[model samples]
Target: MGGEAVQTDITTEHIERLITAAGSHGVTGAIKELGVARTGSIVIDELVFRCEPPRNRHAVPVRIDLVHGTEKAVHVLRLADGEPVTSSEEAPEDACVRLEFDLAELVTLVYGVPRERSAGVHRSELLLAAWPRLTAAYGISDHELMGSVQRAVDSVLGGLSHRRPSLNELAVRYGSDKWSVIHWFTPHYDRHLRDLRNEPVRVLEIGIGGYAEADSGGESLQMWKRYFPRGLVLGVDIVEKHGLDAARLRTVRGDQSDRAFLASIAEQHGPFDVIIDDGSHVNEHVLATFDALFPHLRSGGFYVVEDLWTAYCPGFGGDDENLDNPGTSLGLLKGIIDRIHHEERDGADPDHVARNTVGLHVYHNIAFIQKGVNAEGRIPAWIPRSSDEINPR
Candidate 1:
């Protein structure tokens, strides 16, 4: 199938099943079901990984193919100084080194857990023959050609390994502001989400970052993709993010404050395991999004709110003087605390947030609200309601 055809047929469920098959059936069996075309589309076309810079200053075009029986899907990638500048199905006319693998082996390398070491890389014999021709035709020295090949091999191996960088490391690598001086949110995320690393969970983050620039943001989205190896991560932005979609990462354009829009996105893509509000940070916008999206969060999932400092900033619809202002995000959180203990108070009537929320963890400028059944029965009415009655004062 052509790349377009593969793209049209492939869905999130298709990719998730491919990952599951790789884990359960092993390479040989998975190849029988996955086929070469769909595997190539996922690895080369969808998860277009950024490679480490080549040791040499020259650019290299490496062709990768997924082979299943006699059928193969070929993709040529041009890498310059570590960045993947171009990718196409058309093979280059000029001689170049080629990397080939069984279709299922490629799938295992991309989706298997770190402990899985069954996937093997196979280098084509033509690589040896191409070196001499490359030296003569391109005027590249034998040493330079070898360096380029080594770099290409290293880059491919790095991506294929299931072992991933930590959230902080990925944050720096992807240029996200999450771990920087302004906000140290990665460590907290790691603490909360480390257990869910291998599960096929859906994650939604409200903000897409780079305000208006179409191509500038999505650093955190990349970090989440790496952090949750089996996750399907979605980012919602007010502006269109033209080139940010990837194998498991998707971007949707919408306003966070619009309850209907939030509900629609959640309905379409969610029952999410995690929902993070790193959006506009305007207190009202944050509050509105929480109310609209929290119900869509799956039971035992986490709903996170970042930039709580905005709750005190007047410019962002916050009131510093009245910290208890019910209009702000912090105020809403304070109210939830009461809801958590709603059973303790006489004549207390719990609302939706109170009925569903089981745990509330608040840090300096962020909070993680755990969703679950909050229905521990209230104190028995037979118990004395007043301290005076109990003490007999």
Candidate 2:
């Protein structure tokens, strides 16, 4: 050939891998046939999948390539839920969030790296698929949505943050404003931080107790440290044992429900850009703390409370099973979320009237709550005034 088309070297191992997968006998002892195929090298990456139902959410393992973030080639395979839309065909310009996997992300997932923790964006579609199968075998929701429910919320929020303008366009055409409701704080930890100011931003999270103490508070504080290294994070726990490096995060001692205690911290701290309660899950404490310190929140700040199931749990305040003994306070979150959802504030839900349910979700499995400031808000009454003290009955 006058000009040979560039040919790269190939390996027999890569060839055999493909054939083996094609002939791969699945658990049923049948030959495996995947719907799609490609070849690429593995590199450091992560994979996540979220299914909201009427659907369950699951996460795949954390796959880490020992090699540096470099490139390598390997075979690629895919199985789509509905149809295959390749680059040539292009996913039809549509109203749905689409999935696209980099070659490295795909390879790492299929190779099945060992994972110590499998949550957050570290979750993968493969894990989600396998989890249901596993639960089916055990016949239990044992591997319920906890490990990855927040990941699902993250997916929705991530998509919404990117497609706000598209969503507005859809609303104008569809004569429906409901899409905005759907997008609110869907996946948990669904954080949308405002631009960090030149002033050192500080965040104080209360009730870093047990799980929230470990996961939400710890992880969120870490995120602040990472995303806004110039920022400071403080965590307070009831047990006085908050996790994380305390140099950056100061752990305080006091009942999150106690106005005196919370006010003290607020007074000492002066102001905070963000304050989250992962604590008492006690409604009184949540409402009280919000009232006392919310004003201290920086303009456009975020104040979030996690695990709002208490409002509906009879033991907490509403009438639900105490199956898990999530504690009396967990139920309070239900009321808080309900208030946010119904906007049972000063007036009716004018902004939220037709919207009986808020974009806020009641994940029966994990009760989480979130709130953000509206710079232009008239601030509704039902949002809970700090001093509307409801003594625990």
Candidate 3:
């Protein structure tokens, strides 16, 4: 269903101009990339980007679709250097695994990785740009990790987790312990999440930074403001991420872990549809947030906490509740699994305060989540009626 194309002269200026034209609607278009090094042309509609092509030869036109998004998929099309090649044995269409990148400026954006500078353009982009040239541009066929992504599915309900950021990225970010931030991949991320589900959805992103306060109106909130147009959003951070699309968003300031804060949230946005814990990857903070707010989640709603791996390493451990070793969450989730699968045997008791909701899965990826509900699509267990309810497993 997805294919590539060949165009000429795709430049930054051209992209900028087109995006400007997009205004409120945002840019929606596609590009055809090609070449093997200083070879073919990079065309984005009428505009063309001048860049090197691939090395192995052949001028085959690779037709790829920016299917998730036509206008905002500029970042995904970054790999498509425009040069219409007829045929080539190596980079063939049948090749299921492919990694693409812009080769020339690998160092600064990567090695000697620049510390985050809020003053400049969106920091994430600067870093990704320095990545090694030409890496996997689409579909990852990792047999083992598929289940991991599946776990993520049960945790979030709608979001799809792809094996993004290639091997070189792994080596670099994890290798140097470098903080690999992301630049705005606009259309790609938006398009992807949008295409993920047809149902209308809203999300609550918590834990923004101090710099992103209201006085200055931070960029993070602004980014989400535009990204999710149809869906509603509620953001909570220690410091506000300003410029939120107030028309469709609610920005609040409170402790991400405080019960009072959580209650206020429930009162204000009580029962969010999707909650993302992108802030304060701390254990106590995570546990506290989940404990109080999860009950308020809509049935079949999504509750997510990013950076779950922190529960393992001792250095990153925050509070004892986080239970760093096997992850407090893992222990909790495992018990839930036991409760759900082996009910009645070992405290399989199903009497929960928030009864009726189903306990689905456990995972230790970048984030952890609880992603489902009962047949009624409403949280089944408001009150823990079973013995397991008295003592959280």
Which ranges of candidate 3 are over 4 A from the true structure?
1-200, 210-227, 242-245, 315-327, 342-346, 351-364, 367-393
Q: What alpha-carbon RMSD in Å does predicted model 2 have with respect to the real structure?
A: 21.0
**Alpha-carbon shift of residue 304 in model 2 (angstroms):** 0.8
Best by TM-score: 1
Local distance difference test values of all predictions, in order = 0.77, 0.40, 0.40
TM-score of candidate 2 versus the correct structure, residues matched by position = 0.36
Ranking by lDDT: 1, 2, 3
Between candidates 1 and 3, the TM-score winner:
1
Which ranking of candidates, highest TM-score first? 1, 3, 2
Task: Looking at model 2, report the run of 10 residues with the lowest lDDT sum.
Answer: 42-51
Q: Taking the tens digit of each residue's C-alpha lDDT, what string does model 3 give over 2-43? A: 112243344333433332323333222212222221111221
Error of 3 at 16 (Å): 32
How does model 1 score by TM-score? 0.86
- List the candidates' TM-scores in order: 0.86, 0.36, 0.42
Estimate the Cα RMSD of every predicted model relative to the unseen true structure.
3.9, 21.0, 18.1
